[model samples]
Target: MAEENRYTFTVRQATEADWPGVIDALTSAFEHDPVMNNVMGGDGKSQKVRDLFGFQIRHTYGPKGTIDVAVTEEGKILGAALWISPEGQKGGLIDEIRALPEYAKVLGAGLLRAAIVDLKLLAARPKFPHWLLYTIGVHEDARGHSIGSHLLDFRRFQLGELPAYLEASTYRSAKLYAQHGFVELFRFKSGKPVLGMLHPAPVTQVSKNNPAGR
Candidate 1:
């Protein structure tokens, strides 16, 4: 286990090289979400979903939309967070992901569901530029040690001045987001809540205090 004062790791932009590990992490993380099972199918659907997501993210958007990976001293992927800048293009990944043969049918259905929910939510809320928090998953064994919080912190650090957004698939995660200063923007299909947060740009004073620039 990584110690408190010595949680040594590096955060880097994820690459195609990280796809296999990200797939495995996403599978493990979402396996426990009953709604993911209901909508996308269960663990049985994990591989297809993971493959489609990885392909779309790595191939379509490339690094302009960031995927950050946290790796341990031993070079194991501890956790990851995917973010899309509010100023970046939207829905390209959705089209690419929905076009995958293995996932096409369910993907279409899921989007249709999202469309209805998105419309309803939009009707009640003011539109804001958002940094879409597509996914965040940590290895199961790493839970309860602030790994999740650390991952979010790392992503916020990377974002600098960007605002963050996410749709939480579980109530527990909504609470977690609340704890981290995210505001509930709206509730969507299946009771999932969309959250909005912002990360302030790093202060020059703070960076000046560090021996090395972070």
Candidate 2:
């Protein structure tokens, strides 16, 4: 089972023009994700799921935070990662209210349920100045090629000394993150369990001489 990993794809900041590719990769990747299917009321191919991802990417994330996509030299996108700056966290009730219409579009009758699940996940996040690894996914066709790892590597480099927080949608995804230095904080269960993980700042190593590791 083997060949070289594709260094062919280079990660770069995404643009509005990249929406089609980004959405394709995201939807394909999460096609079988139970939590997402439950939220969108169908599989990733459903219009509801596509609409929600589009809303977040094109409207909120692109304008407010950062979205990075991995593209090959020939211009094919293999994956995308969305991040929220510490100052851009939308953990406020006002922000949630603002997104009501959009969430309602995809969630429809399940809006409240989706909101509750989102609140549960949000509440599990650490309250600190850190980047939020909002969402990341690799196209189904590109899985096993290490695209996910490359994306995470770029984020780690971009992060510098700042920590990163994320709620891993599945244990499998959590393991992938663990390889990149994230440790599980807690597992929140609201039907499907999500693992909350954090990649502590490199500064956590400053405890070399200190007895208790901060």
Candidate 3:
């Protein structure tokens, strides 16, 4: 008989000490993106995938922010999500997005503000506070285990019903986002489609039948 594969992992809010692992996973996940290169603009190099993830970790998750992780029982870092909430803020969470260099270069001040208005309009309904899921990734060695979906669910529990948003870098990931209840709100015309998606709550269904392993 074939040996059975048994592995178990869980998701939780990432601590400051988890930043390095998160960065490594993110770098490994996005190291070969032609569209990201174009988005960088100057000579198509903005920051190393690792460095960019590191900077976002430092800038956004510093004092009081949100970053969630999925880790194996044996302590392997599988996936992560870095995000922010605008519950007590005067406006939408897109303000935090505008502070990121990637969004700044692509979206002008007027467009940014206009987007914020749209965000506010959608999230102003009762029981909704906006969140920005800046980045999420699953490590190559741990891809098939539904780790990404678990990480997203963990983030939702951490943030408690806050509407979440993210920019999907690939159609594969966009489909993954959709599987997790993220609906595309916009798409950027570029080397590859960059999809912006939103979800009123985290997705609960996770498929363990797919072939997305590394």
RMSD of each: 6.1, 3.6, 9.3
lDDT of 3 by residue, 1-214 (tens): 1111355766777777878888878767666654444434323232455655676577656444677787667666677877767743434356456665664544334344435433543443334457877677787776677777777766666545457777777888899889877898776644143677888654322323333532
Q: Tell me the tens digit of each residue's lDDT in model 1 across 73-115.
A: 7777767777777655456446544655544443656655544
TM-score of 3: 0.66
TM-score per candidate: 0.70, 0.88, 0.66
Model 1: CA > 4 A from native:
1-8, 42-44, 60-63, 91-126, 158-160, 193-214
Instruction: Judging by TM-score against the true structure, name the best candidate.
Output: 2
In order of listing, the candidates' clash counts read 0, 0, 0
Better of 2 and 3 by lDDT: 2
Off by over 4 Å in 2: 1-7, 90-92, 204-214
Name the 10 consecutive residues with the lowest summed lDDT in model 1.
193-202
Candidates in order have lDDT scores of 0.61, 0.80, 0.63
Best by lDDT: 2
TM-score, structure 1 vs. true: 0.70
**Model 3 local distance difference test score:** 0.63
